[model samples]
Target: MKRSPMKPGKPLVRTPFKRTSPMPSTGMLSVQSHQRTAPKRKAGLKSKGPVSTPIRRAARGQDCTLRLTVCNFDPDTTVLCHSNYLADGKGMGLKAPDTAAAFGCSACHDVLDGRRPRPADLSLAGLEAAFRAAVSHTHEILRSMGLLDAAPAAIQPTLEHP
Candidate 1:
């Protein structure tokens, strides 16, 4: 029978399980090409050339800068806690471990490598303004479709036509 081995001076090796991303990975969201101006699209199929005007506000939803809380390293595990290079900050150097309101070091890094580790993510409450705006837009779409009686009360102040 085969047996697992332990060295004379070392502890028995425990094979680690595979780890998975804690965050709903946006890994596939990559830059197709760096746009100097931004791609222009036609408003309708019948239009020949691209729309003359710059992208509309709604089309530029991702233009806003957002802060991301990041932990550079887990000293205990010797693992990096970066979500993305830009999101986590470029290059290597230990971070102060600020412990964002929603996450502490250990809990935020439940998973390492391929193991079923804990993964912590920031709450959407931090983006309350954006979320409210999105919901308001969605409500308007629904209202225009006759599915809603009116735009939601939260979005009322920003409602242009309603």
Candidate 2:
């Protein structure tokens, strides 16, 4: 009778496998490499454009206004999370204006952006309301920090006399 020292379903010997590149030996550049080296066109004209990087940068170290049940409340993860509603200018492949943003931690941002599920206690309308409230609170914070202008006033049209 003989006994085996090797464990069951285990290989007693192993060998390293070498992988070969699919590219030709002539050093022809790959499509991906060529694309990577190509100059990229910057999106959106910054001159008189809607781009507001300063406002986004101001969100750093700010408290999460969208304090959802899933909120992390970690200042490091906070940022100016833009509103996803179309009324706020959010659309396909487009973000809302920075003014319509709220300071949100990663978790709360995920929930607000629909990347994570909403809390059990909150309905769709409730979530929307909470996000709106957070946006308003963040606006006040930004205004206090001098990052935003005062809220615009309603314009009334005057009747002209004959």
Candidate 3:
């Protein structure tokens, strides 16, 4: 049998996939691109501003120039730091409120979040203790500033025992 020479420049033709309807103008497949469109808002629903969380409320009540409470390493820059337990999904079952959050620098926050390795001398337990202490201090500061409501008398122990 004699073989025919193939064309040097011509490309093979491909059969286009058939669709019940034409694809969108964006050139994306219709079904896969549905989510790319903006979502429709429900009727009678008004957009509201961001709701203030307890942590934010407490932080705002403090002096903006304050340093990170955990390491006290950064005096000029600080950010809110929530409990590692909270970020780890373990604090959901605990009674700790949003006010339990403390202030820390990016490094300390990273360490707490396990994104960075802990210091050679510092243990996870030590860091947690420091965070808790910072939270307590923050609460006190908030309380002194009249941001947080006073603790219930029942929760405070009396020195005099009946």
Best by lDDT: 2
- Sort the candidates on lDDT, descending order: 2, 3, 1
Q: Write one digit per residue (lDDT tens) for candidate 1, span 1-162.
A: 698675688866556863342435576763433335866976654545433222111222221112223433333422212221233333354332211111113323333212333225544343443323433444454356454476336644565785
Count of clashes, each model: 9, 0, 0
> For candidate 3, lDDT tens digit of each residue in 1-162?
698787989887767965556565886555654434678989857546545665565454233221323344653445566665745334643434556566666666677677878778776677777777777777776678676777767666569878
lDDT of each: 0.34, 0.86, 0.61
Regarding TM-score, does 2 or 3 come out ahead? 2
Q: Per-residue lDDT of 3-112 in model 2, one digit per residue for the tens?
A: 96778998676559533455665677656543226667687634555465988999899999999999887999998899888998999878888988899999999998
Question: Could you tell me how far off, in angstroms, the CA of residue 124 lies in candidate 3 after the best superposition?
Answer: 1.8
Residue pairs with colliding backbones in model 1 are 18-114, 18-115, 19-113, 19-114, 19-115, 110-117, 110-118, 111-117, 111-118
Ranking 1 against 2 by TM-score, winner: 2
Off by over 4 Å in 1: 1-126, 151-162
Best by TM-score: 2
TM-score of 1: 0.19
